[model samples]
Target: MRSEEEVFALLIGFAKSDERIRLVSLEGSRANPAIADDEFKDYDIAFFVTDMESFLSKDDWLDFLGKRLILQKPEDMELYPPQLGNKFSYLMLFEDGIKIDLTLVPISELQSCLKRSDGLLKILLDKDNTVKEEIVATDQHYWMTKPTAQKFTDCCNEFWWVSTYVAKGLARQEFLFAQDHLNQIVRPTLLLMMSWKIGAEKGSSFSLGKNYKFIQHYLAAEEWELLLQTFQGSGYSETWEALFLCQKLFRTISKKVALAYGYDYPNYDERVTPYVQGLHTKCS
Candidate 1:
C-alpha cells in the first residue's frame, strides 16, 4: 500500500507534469482538519483541466495513477445516470487497497465550482493564480442545524405515515417489503428526529457525521441500546418488535425536541400507533 506522502507526491507530480491539468484541489474528509486521518479515507481530488475531451479520449492517462483493482466511471455508465454536469469522475480502487475518487472539472467552470463547493477544499496547485482568496477547509457546512417547526412536524408525520407500510408488509408476510420500508424510510426518519434532539441539546455547531454515524456518542446508554434493538432479526415477530421500538424511541426524542423548541408536536403517532397495533394483533 502507498503511504499518504507517496500518494500526495504522485498526485501533485502528475498535476505539475501535465500543463493541461492546471489546478488540483483535495476535497471531502481529506480536506477537513477536524476529521482524523485514516487509511480508509479516499484521496478525493479534483483536477481543473484545459481540455476534458483529451483526457476522456483515452484510458492510458489513468495508468499513471496506479494499477487499479477496479474502476467506475459514473458518467460513462448507462444504469446510473450522470449527476455531475460538465464534470467527470473516476472512482478507482488500486491493487494496493487505496481508493481515489478523482474528478475532472473544466477550467471554464472554476468559478461555478467554487460557488458549489461545500467549503471542504484544499487547493494543491493553481498555476495561473486563478484562486485569489484563501481556501479554508471546514466541515462546518455539514454541521447540524436547529430544525424549524414545520420541518420537525414534517419529520414526525413522515415517520408515522410510512411506518404503516412496514405494518402492512409484515401483516401480509412480505418480509423483504417490510424490511425495506423499515430500513429505508422509518429508520431514516427516526434518525432525523434523533439528530434534531441532539442538536437541540448540544447546540448546532457540531456535526453528527455523514448519515449520523457519530450519533451513538451523543445518545444515552439505554437510548442507544433501544436504537440498536430497532435493528432486529429476520423473523416476523422480530420485525414487529423493531417497528414498535422505533415508534417508542421516535416518540420520546421528538417530544423532547418539540418541548425544547416550543413546536407543537403532531398527533399522527396517536392515530398511527393503534392501526399498526391492530395489524400486528390480526397477523398473530
Candidate 2:
C-alpha cells in the first residue's frame, strides 16, 4: 500500500502540473479531524477545473495515479443513473491497495458545491485562491440534531405503520418480503428514534456517524446486544423475535425523548403491537 504522504504528493503534483485543474480539495473522512486515521480511508479528492469536459473525455491521464484493481465512473455508467448533477466522479482502487474517490467539478459550480458541502472539506491546492475563506473540516454537519415535535411523531408513525408490512410478510411466510420491510423501513425508523433519544441525552453537538455506525459506542452493553438481536432474521421465529425486540427498544427510547421534550408520544405502537402479536400467534 502507498503511504498517505506518497499518495497525497502524487495527487498534488498531478494537479499542479495540470493547468485546467485550478483547485483541489480533500473531502469525506480523510478531511475530518475527529475521525481516527485508518488504512481503509479513501483519498476523497475534488478537482475544481476550468473545463470538466477535458478530464471527462479521456481516461489516459488517470494512468498518472496508479495501476487500478478496478475503476468505476459513476456518471458514465448506464445502469446506475448519475446523481451528481454538473459533476463527475471516479471511484478507483489501485493494485497498491490505495483507494481514491476523485470528483471533477466545473469552476462555475464551486459556490454551489460549497453550499451543499457537509463541512468536511480541506483545500489542498488553489492556484487562483478561488476560495478566500479558510475551510476548516469538521463532522459537525453530520451531527445529531434535535427532532421537532412533528418529526418525532412522524418517525413513530412510520415505524409502527411499516411494521405491519413485516408482520404481513411473515404471516404469509414470505421471508424476503418480511426481512426487507424490517430491515429497510422498520429498523431505520427505530434507529432514527434512537438517535433522537441519544441527541437528547448526549447533547446534539456530535454525530453517531454515517448510518449511525458509531452508535454502539454510545449504547449500553445490553441495549447494544438487543439492537444486534434485531438483525437476526434467518427463520420465521427469529424474524418475529427481532420485530418484537425492535418494538421494545424503540418504544423505550422514544418515550424518554418525548418526555424530555414535553411532546406527546403517539399510541401507534399500542395499537400496532397486539395486531402484530395476533399475526405471530396465527402464524404459529
Candidate 3:
C-alpha cells in the first residue's frame, strides 16, 4: 500500500506532467481538517481538463496511477445514469487497496463548478491561477441545523409511519420491501434523530459525518452496541428485532431532542410500537 505522501506525490506529479489536465483539487473528507485521519479514506480528486472526452477515449493514461483492481466509469455505463450532469469520473480501486474518485471537468466549466461547490473543496494545483477566490476547506455547510418544532414533528411522524411498511412486509414475507424500508427510510430517520441529539449536546455546530459515520463519538457504548444490532441479520426474525431496536433508539433520541428544544413528542409512538409488535408476533 502506498503512503499518503507517496499517493499525493504520484497524484500531483501526474497532473503536473499532463497539459490536458490544467488544474487539480481535492474534495470530501480528505479535504476536511476536523475528520480524524484514517488510512482507508479515498483520494477524491477533481481535474479541470482541456478535453474530458479525449481522456475518456483512452485506457493507457490511467496506468500511470497504479495497477487498478477494478474501476467504474459511471458516465460510460448504461445501467447507471450520470449524476454529475456535465462532468465525467472514474472510480478506481488500485491493487494496493487505495481508492481514488477522480472527476474530469472541462476547463470551460470552472465558473459553474465554483458555483455548485460544496464547502469542503481544497485546491491542490492551479497552474493557470484561475481560482481567484479563497479555496479554504470547511465543513460549515454540513453542520447540523437545529430543527424547527414542525420539522421535528415531521421527522418523528415519518419514522413511525414508514415503520409500518417494514412490519407489513415482514408479515407478508416480502423481504425486499421490509429491507428497503428498514435501510432506506427507517435507519436514515434514526440517524437524523441521532444527529439532532448529538448537535444539541455538541453546540449544534459539528458534522456527524456523511450518513452519520462519526455518530459513535457522541453515542454511549451501550447505545452504539444497540446501533450495531440494528444492522444484524435480515431474516424475518432478525429483521423484526432490528426494526424494534431502531424504534427504541429513535424514540429515546427524538424524545430527548423534542424535550430539549421544548417541542412536542408525538403520541403515535405508543400506538405504533404495539402494532408492530403484534405484526411480528403474527409473523412468528
Candidate 4:
C-alpha cells in the first residue's frame, strides 16, 4: 500500500493542524528500534488532548485517514469491558491495509503517561514540550530474564502440575476445556521454560518478541516441529498425543534450565504424569 513516510506524514500533519491534539507519541512495534519495519506493523499513536469527549463523539475526522474496514472503540463499549482504565482506544484497520491502535488520554495525564511508559515509545509532536528528557524506544521490558533457583523450581512445578488439568478435561470429553488448558495454561508454561533456556544460551537481555513469536529463530528445526505437534486436533486421542508431547518438551527444556542453575525438579512431575496417564485411560 502506501509508504511508511506517507502514512506518518498524514498522521503528524493531521495532529499538527488540530489545536486540541496537544501531544502525539508512537508505541508498539513501530516505535521499537530492534524491530524491522513492515507494512503489517501498526501505527500505535497516542494523542494527549484537550477535549477527549468531543473527539470520542465523532468518527468524521478518522474518515480522512483511510476507508475504514472495521474498528473497535473499547472504552465506548460495555460488553468487552475496558482494560485501559481511564484511556480510550480506537483499534482501526483501514481499507488499504494500514492498522492504527490510537489511544486518547487527557492532556492532564501526560505526566502519568511519561511515568508509566514501557520505554517502547517515541514522542512525535509536543506542543507545550511536556516531556523534558529524550525518549528512546527499547524492547527491554520483554527481555529474557534469568530466573532465580526458586523461580526455576516454580516454573517446573507449575508446568507438570497444570498439565493434569488437560488430562482431566480430555477424560471428561470436554474438548474446549482441555483446549483452553492446553492453549492458555500449559502452553505459556512451556513458552516460559523455553525462554529460560534461551536466556541461558544467549544473553538474558534480549527479547523473544510478543507471545514468543521469535522463539523458532532460536529453536532447532526438529524441536520447533515437535513443538508445533503439541497443538493437536479436537479429538481425545489427538489431545492426548499433544499432552504427551508437551510433557516431553517441558521435561527436556525445564531439566536443562534447572540443572544449569542447580534447581531441583519438583516431585509433582514424578506423580502427575502417571496420574494423568491413568486418568486418560478412562477416555478410551
Q: Can you give the TM-score per candidate against the true fold?
A: 0.97, 0.97, 0.94, 0.97
lDDT agreement with native, every candidate: 0.93, 0.92, 0.90, 0.87
Candidate 3 per-residue C-alpha lDDT over 117-194 given as tens digits, one digit per residue, 9 for 90 to 100: 788888889999999988888898898999999889989999999999999998999998999999999999898988
- Predicted candidate 2 versus true structure: per-residue lDDT over 58-106, tens digit per residue: 8989999989999999999999999999999999999988999999999
Model 3 poorest 10 in a row by lDDT: 232-241
The digit string of per-residue lDDT tens for model 4 on 125-154 reads 998888888988999988888999888878
* Clash number for candidate 2: 0
Backbone clashes under 3 angstroms, per model: 0, 0, 0, 0
Give a tens-digit lDDT track for model 1, residues 164-249: 99999999999999999999999999999999998888898878888888899999999999999999957999999999999999
Instruction: Output the lDDT of residue 34, model 1.
Output: 81
Question: So what's the TM-score on candidate 1?
Answer: 0.97
Candidate 4, after superposition: displacement of residue 100 in Å? Answer: 0.8
| Residue-level error in angstroms, candidate 4, position 133 | 1.2
Q: Rank the candidates by lDDT, best first.
A: 1, 2, 3, 4
Q: Is candidate 3 or candidate 4 better by TM-score?
A: 4
